[model samples]
Each structure stands twice: as C-alpha cells, then as structure tokens.
Target chain A: MIPYLACVLLFLIGLYVVISKRNLIKIVIGFSLIEYAVNLFFALVGFKKGALAPIITQPEQVRMGVARNFVDPVPQALVLTAIVIGLSTTALMLSLAMRLYEKYKTFDISEIRRLKG
Target chain B: MEGRILPLFVAIPLAGAFLVPLLSKLWTRFADLIASITSALLLGVSVYGWLMVNAGGMPLHYWVGGWRIIGIAMWFDALTALIVLIINIVGFCASVYSIRYLDRYTGGRWKFFTLLLLLIAGLNGLAISGDLFNMFVFIEISAIASYALVAFGTEEEEVEAAFKYMVLGEVGGAVLLFGIALIYARASTLNLAHLSQVLAGFGRTPFYWFVIATLLIGFAIKMGMEPFHAWLADAHFSAPAPISAMLSGVFIKVTGVYAMSRLMFNVFGVSRAETPAFFNLLIAFGAVSMVLGGLLAYTQNDYKRLLAYSSISQIGYILVALGIGNFWGIAGALFHILAHALGKGTLFLASGSVERQTGTRNLEQLKGLEKTMPATTWSHILASFSMAGLPPFAGFFSKLFIIIGAIAARMYWLAFLAALFSAVTLGYLTKVVNMAFFVKQNSSVTSTREAPGLMVLAMLVLVVLTVAVGVGFRGVLDHLVGPAARVLLNGLEYARLVLGG
Candidate 1:
C-alpha cells in the first residue's frame, strides 16, 4: 500500500516538473521520470512478498502448489517493454531539446514561443 | 471468418516503413513509389475487409503465434474495418499528395514517407488491437512517429509546435497506460475481451470510475476537446499540409475519439441508461467544444489555423452525436467520422496547395485564387461546402442525423445547438472562400497555377469521395455506418463477439 502511494507521488512530482519547469532539458527529464514511475509501478504490481521465480524446472515441484507461489511474470515483461519505449522516446525528446537549444541559443522554454496557442 | 489477412494490415505498412528508407538509398523516387503503392495496397485490403465484415462474417480474431490468450490478439469487426478504411483512404491520398506536395519542404522524401508508414501502421494496429497494453504500445508507436514528422521541417516554429505536441501526446500516452495498468491489476488480464467479461461484474466502483475518468481524460486530450486543446491548433498549423491533413482529418479521430468510444462503450460497458452522468459528461464536453471551437475559428486569419480550429469544431459534433448514445446518435457519429475525414482532408490539402503556390497562408494577403488555381479553389469550395453541412454534400447528412439523434434523446437545446453550429460551420468556412477565392486580386501573389497533377489528383480523389459518399449516402449508411454503430451500441455484446471468436 505504501509503495503504491509512493509510486503515485513520484508520478505527480514528475507531472509537476513538466507543468512548472521552464527548462527544456528539465522537461525531458520530467517526462522520463513520469515514464520510469509508471514502469516501476508496473513492475511492483506482480511482486509477492515470498514468491519464487516463475519457473518450473521440476514437474513434481509444480504439483506441490508451487506455481501459485510463483511471482506473476506478465507485469515484469510489460515493464521491460515499457522501459525500451521510454528510453527511445526520452532520447528523441532530448535530441529535440538539443535542436531547440541550437535554434534558440537557450534552454529556456519560455524563449521558444514562436507558435501560439 | 477467414483470418489470415488480418496481420497484413500491420505487416504491410510496417514492412513499407523500413522498405521506403532502404529503397530510397538506391533512388529517391522509389520512396514515393513504394509509399503510394503500399498505401494503395492497404486501401485495397481495407476495402476487402470492409466487404468481408459487411457480409456478416465479422468479429474475426487471430492470435499471434497461435498462443491464444497468451499471445497478442488481433480482432477485426465492423468498427475496426471502418477506422482502418478511413486511415488507409486518407493515408493513400496523403501519400500521393506528398509526392509533389513535399517539394516545398527540405527533408529527404524517404524519411517523411517512412515516418508516414510508421504512423499508419500504428493506427491500423490500434484499430485492431485486442489487448489494452498492445493498444498503448501502438499508440506510442504512432505518437513517436508523429512527433518526428511534426518536426520534419526542423524550422523554428515547427520544432516548437512539435515539442509542445510531443510533451502533451507523451503525457496522454502515460495517462492511458496508467489506466490500462489499473485495469490489468483488477481483472488480472490484458485481453480486452477477457477484461470486458471480468469487469462486467465489477459494477461502478470508485476505482472503476477513477480508471474510466483517467482514460477518458487521456483520450479527450488526444481528441483535442475544448479544454485540453492547447496543443492542437499549433501542431496542425505548424505541420506541413499533408501532415496537417492527416493530423486534422484522421489522427485525432483514430487516436482520440475512436479509441475513447470503443473503450467506454465496449470494455467498460457504459450505457446512457445505466450511466447517465457518463453520457452527460460527454455531452457537456461536446457542447463546450462546439461553441468554443466555432467561435474561435471565426477569429483566425491564417488559413491553416482556421481549418485547425474547424477540425476541433467538427470533432465536437461527432462527440455530441456519440454522447447522445441512441441508435440515430451512434449512426450519426459514425457517419460524421467519415464525412469529416473526407471534407477536412481535402480542405487541408487545398490549403497546402495554396500555400505552396502563393508562398503565403495569410487570408488577408491572398485573393482571386479561383482565377489562377482553379483546381485548388474548387477543391476548397467543395470540401468547405461539405464541412459547412450544406445541401448535396456529405456533411449535411451527418449533421441531420446528429440533430435527429439529439431530438430523440429529448435534448432539445442540444439538438438546437447542433443545428446552430452547422450554420456556424458554414459561416466560418465561407469566410475562407470569401477571403481567399472570391475576393479580387489586389496583387499577383496568385501567380502560380494549379498544384502539381498528383497533388490535384489526390485532392480530387478525396473531393470525389465526399461527393460520392453524399450521393451514395444510403448505401454507406446501410452497409458501413450501420454495422459499426450497432457494434458500439450493443456495448458488452462486443465481449461475446470476441470471446466467442
């Protein structure tokens, strides 16, 4: 319960940085933080306190109800996929930030206001 | 139902995305050729799939790697067919248009075409995705490609808009994933069919509402709803014309409106009777967006900017119809999706042509385009009429049905508002015509002739489709729109359809 709340807190802090920060690189970092928080939450979702690895090397061990105690592997797999996606996107965002800095000669988002809302 | 062809929807475009760049290294022209051929092939497959589903052999399912529930599932039904068809149609037109239309931009044609294919692949996969996590991944694939494409020009304004768009779109993707995660935790399954069956008994718990709200907010942002639309106008305005057309015409519908409607109605099993507040929230969002988008569009002087706002207004119209949640309402929503895609697509493509020829999109500076750029002007005239809901155009029937649906739902004021916005759409769309096409030339900025033959041909294709759909409104309504709406209207029956498959 505490860990879930902590994950939510991390997500909110990341979102806050995205909303409040003025630096473009910081904004990219903020996005990464949000994604990492979500990935962490996903990984934690499948964790059981005393669970064994989700592998059955012995068929007799599987018959001892060991399968039920095995940690669910789905969320871990999901987290792996999520981390790769997060890495690529964060890299893309950072490259864009580099280009924006070259264009504007500053890292401040407030300076990159050519397109209006 | 035969299911072997289902994977081709993703495979063709995914393969084309890589092939375009590799083939382009040998020759640049091959990029255009490969992209056009790929989109045309996808369009053909979508047509065949539409026919197959329309023949009542629908709700086909394919388990990737034949792993059944453990592997990724691809489900094809009326709704998937409808969206895939729309994506490929606009995609085909956009690809053809881009062949000549891209001359103005400075990028290699290969890069643009590759990203375009990637975007299309993601949308197609999103439409057929039977797993919530896969949908999220496809959403990211499309979002990532679009972010790059939006910045394809690498100009100052384009970069800024792309960054803004990227930030918002990525956040929306995260929010959507969070919702998907919550659902997975609760139902202990990722398959949408399985989730639907399991969640059907959960009722409206606080957690359920929380997840639904998070997902709705995520999609609403993607759809460019009135309140969450800060990124839309800028992104649409900054994107190149073909990208503009794709973004305004199909991207918003596919990523935002279609995804939201499918989830709310099917997986969550929301109904008007059982969840009046859910429906009402949608109605409120629709009402605000229509009024605000129309009023804001009327004030824009930039041609692309106005069309961007008008896209928002038209999206509002579709949302209102869906929110009504009646038979006529659902059908009207589906039809409006088609009508708006064709009409708005031509309008953006025409705007691109005008900008390409004159080197300006400022409505204040350009005039007498009907004399110099007849093809583009006529495309503008026809698509604007359709968008304005004028008679003998495709947009009219959609507006009529939405009004009827609103009336059926006993929402008299909302019905009146829908009618009023039709007129409002006409007023703003006419502003484009009067300023750009009808006004006499004070200067010879209109020196250029028609857009390139292929661009004109692409615009003509969409214009013809709009007119053909309007003329063949009955057949489309009976065949395409009807089944799509029924699938959505039946809500939880989607579970039976897929799980049974």
Candidate 2:
C-alpha cells in the first residue's frame, strides 16, 4: 500500500515538474521521472508476497500450485519494453536539447523563442 | 493470399531500414533506390491485401510463432486493410518525393531513410496487431521514430519543436501505458479478442470508465484533437517537406484516430452502446477543433502552419462523423481519411516544391507562381479546392456524408456548424490561393521555377488519387468504406470471428 502511494506521488511529482519547469534539461528529467514512476507501478502491480520466480524446473511443479506461487511475469516484461522506449525518448530529447543549446545558447525552454504554438 | 502476407508489410521496411545505411556506404544513391522499392512493394502488397479481404469477406488472422489464443497475432480485416493501404501508398509517394527534396539536407539520407522505414514499419504493425500491449509497443516505435524525424533537421526551431512534441507525446504514451496496465490488471488478458470477450462479460465499473477516459485523452493528444493539439502545428511546420507531408497526411490518423477508434469500437464495445456522453464528448471536441482551427488558420502567415491547423480542423470533421456513431457516420469518416490523406499530401508536397523552388514560404513573396510553375499551381489548386469542400471533389462528398450523419443522429446544430466551418475552410484556402498564386510576382524575387521532376511526379500522383477518389467515390463507398464501417458497427462479430462462438 505504501509503495503504491509512493508510486503515485512520484508520478505526480514528475507531472508537476514537467508543467512547471523552465529549463529544458529539467523537463527531460521530469519525463524520465514520470516514466520510472509508471514502470514502478507496473512492477508493483505484478508483485506477489513470498512468491518464487516464474520458472518451473519440472513437470510436477506445473501440476502443483507452482503457477499460483510464482509472481506474474507479464508486467516485468512490459516494463523492460517501457524502459527501453523511455531511454530512446530521453536520448533523442537530450540530443535535441544539445542542438537547441548550440543554436540558442541557453538551457531555458522559455528563452528559445521561434515557433509561437 | 495467405495470412502470411501481413508480416511482409513490416519485414520489408525493417530490412530496408537496416540495409540502407550499409548499402548507401557502398553507393550513395542506393538509399533512394532501396527506400522507394521497399515502399512500392509495401503498397503493392497492401493493395493485394485489400482485394483479398474484399474477396474473401473475412479477416485474415495470423498467429505469430504458432501461439494459438494466448499469444500475439496479426489481424487484418477490411478496416486494417484500409489503414494499411493508406499508410503504404502515401508512404511510397512521400519516399519518392524525399529522394530529391532531401538534397538540401546533407549526409543524412541514410539516417532519414532508416527512420522513415522504422516509422512505416511501426504504422503497419500498429494497424494489424491483435493485442493491446502490442499496439502500445508499435505506437512507441512510431512515436520515437517520429520524434527523431521531427528533429532530424537539427535546426533551432526544429529541435525545439521536436522537444515539445516529444515531451507531450511521451506523456501521452506513458498515460496510454498506464491505461493499458489498468486494463491488464483488471481483465487479466492482453489479447484484443480475449479482452473484448472478458470486458463484455465484466460489468462496467467506475474504474473501467476511468480507464476508458484515460485512453481517450491519451490518444487525443496523439491525434492532435482540439484541446491537446499544441505540438502538432509546430512539429508539422518545422519538419522537412516530405516528413511534413507524411506527418500531417497519415501519421496522426494512424497513431491517434485509428488507434482510438479501434480500441473504442472494437475492443471496448462502445459501438454496441448508445454512449451518449462519449458521443457528446467527441462532438464537442470536434466542433471546437473545427471552428477554432479554422479561425486560427485564418490568422497564420506561415504556409505550413496554416496547413497544420487545417489538419486539426479536418480531423475535427472525421471525429464528428465518428461521434455520430452510425454506419454512414463511420463510413464517411473512413472515406474522409483517404480523401484528406491524398489532398493534404498534395498540399504539403506542393508546399515543399514551392519552398524549394522560390526559397521562401512567405505568401506575400510567393506571388504569381502559377505563371511559372503550372504543374504545381494546378495541382495545388485542385488539392486546395478538394480540402475546402468544393463540389465534385473528394472532401465534398465526405463532408456531405458527415453532415448527413449528424443530421440523422438528430444533431442539427452540429451539422450546421460543420457546414459553417467548411465555408470557413474555403475562405482560408482561397486566401492562400489569392495571395500565393494569383497575385503578380514580387519584384524582388527573380529565380522562381517549376519543381523537380520527382517532386512533380509525387504531387501529380497524390492529385490523381484526390481526383480519382472523389470522382469514383460511389464505388469506393460500396467496396471499401462500407465493409470497414461494418467491421466497427458489428463489434461482437469481431470477437466471435477471432475467438469463435
């Protein structure tokens, strides 16, 4: 329960930073934070107390309550994909930020004024 | 002819994307050859897929790695066929246009083709996937590629716009993932067919409704609907011409609108219910987008920005038709998607030509282009007229059907508003023609010429499609649009077809 609340709080913090931050790099960090929060939530959702890893060593294990005693593996697999996608997005944003800094000579998003919308 | 053809749509582009850079190292121009050939082959296969669906009168579902009911699969129905056809055909034309238009940007043809191929692969994958998580994965692939493509120019405004688009787009993606997570936790299944069956039996709760809203809003940002359209105009205007055409023409529809419709009508069973609130939310957003987008476009001096805003407005029309939530409404929406793809593709490609030829995008400076660039001028006029909902053009019939659908749904005022803003569409577009083409040439400019042969060829192909779809819309309606709409209208049949009764 506490972990779930922490995850939601982390997500809100990221959202707040994204909305309020003036610097481009800070905003990028905010995006990463949001992604981490979501990944955490997915992981938490699939949690099982005292559960073993979702690996079966023998056919007898499958016949017993082995599956029930193991944690759900789907969300972990999902988070792996999410993390990679988040990394790509972060890398691209950082590169764009570097380019923006080169062109505009500032890290402040508000200062880089070209397009109105 | 088999379910096997679906993966080829993704495989061909993926191969070309990776191969282009290595091959370009061997021969610099080989990138162009490979990209065009790859897209053309995709287009051929998509057309064949369309015909196969039409002939067989059922979906072709392919299970990957022979994973029966529980694993991921590719589902190609009439609806998927329509979107796949749009993506590949427009993709081919854009690649053809890019082969020359990319000359201005140095040393990145390989990178450009690589990202473009990835984008095409992602759109194709998104269109045909049979599961929710797979759809999200494909959306990320396309969104990430598009973010890079948006910033590929690496200019000041380009980078800024790309950053803005990425942030908002990433937020949308995260929200979408959260929604999917919520659905997964509750429904305990990821497959669309199985999920639908479970959801249909699982009574609606507030949590379910929350999930629905989250998904809708997330995709709204993606589609650039009225409230969440801040990133669209900037990104569209900043990207290069071919990229701009692809983004405004088909990318938004495939990722945002098509994904939303698929989830809502097919997986979530919105089409089965009257769904007044859902319908009203769509109508409200649609009407606001149409009116606001038109008015804002009227004030824009930038050519591409104007086109981008008009996209928001036109997307509003599609949403309005969809909100009507009837057969003709959805069919009209589908028809409008094709029509706008062709018309807007022509406009963006033509704008690219104009920009390349005159070295200016200012309407004030681009005067009397019609006198010098007759081919481009005529094509632009035809596409602009079609987009403005003029008679005997594609946009007209689609708009007509939408208005009729609204009226049939007893939304008389919404229909009236659609018609009113359509006139506004005509007004702004005419403003474009008068300022950019009809006025006498600016005395300061001396070296305006017709666009390159490839650019003209691409524009002409789009213009021909615009005219053809409009001229022969009756047959289009019967063969393509009707079946596609039926796929949405008959929601339970989708489940039964996929998972058996």
- DockQ winner: 2
How well does each candidate superpose onto the true structure, as a TM-score? 0.98, 0.97
The digit string of per-residue lDDT tens for model 2 on B1-501 reads 368898897899999999998999999899999999999999999999999989988789888888777778789999999999889878999999999899888888899999999999999999999889899999999998899999988988898899899999999999999899888888888989888888988766787689999998889999999999999999999898888888888899999989998988888888526567787788789878888888899998878889999999999988988988887788889989988999999999988888888888887766777788989889989998899888888998888888888788888898888888888988888887888877565534423678889989999999998888889989888888889989989876788888762
DockQ of candidates 1 onward, in order? 0.75, 0.82
| Model 1 residue-pair collision total | 0
Q: Look at candidate 2 and tell me the lDDT of residue B218.
A: 89
Q: Tell how far residue B38 is off in model 2, in angstroms.
A: 0.4
Residue range B122-231, candidate 1, lDDT tens digits: 99999989888998889889888888888888989888888998899888888888888788788889988888989988988999899999999889888899888998
True contacts kept of each: 0.61, 0.78
Model 1 Cα lDDT, one tens digit per residue, A17-99: 99999999999988988998888888888888999878878888757864467788999899888888888798888888988
Clashing pairs in 1: none
> In candidate 2, how many Å is residue B27 off?
0.9
User: Any runs in candidate 2 off by more than 4 Å, and if so which?
Assistant: A56-68, B441-443
- The iRMS of model 2 comes to 0.8
Give the least accurate 10-residue stretch of model 2 chain B, judged by summed lDDT: B439-448
Model 1 off-target regions past 4 Å? Answer: A55-68, B441-444
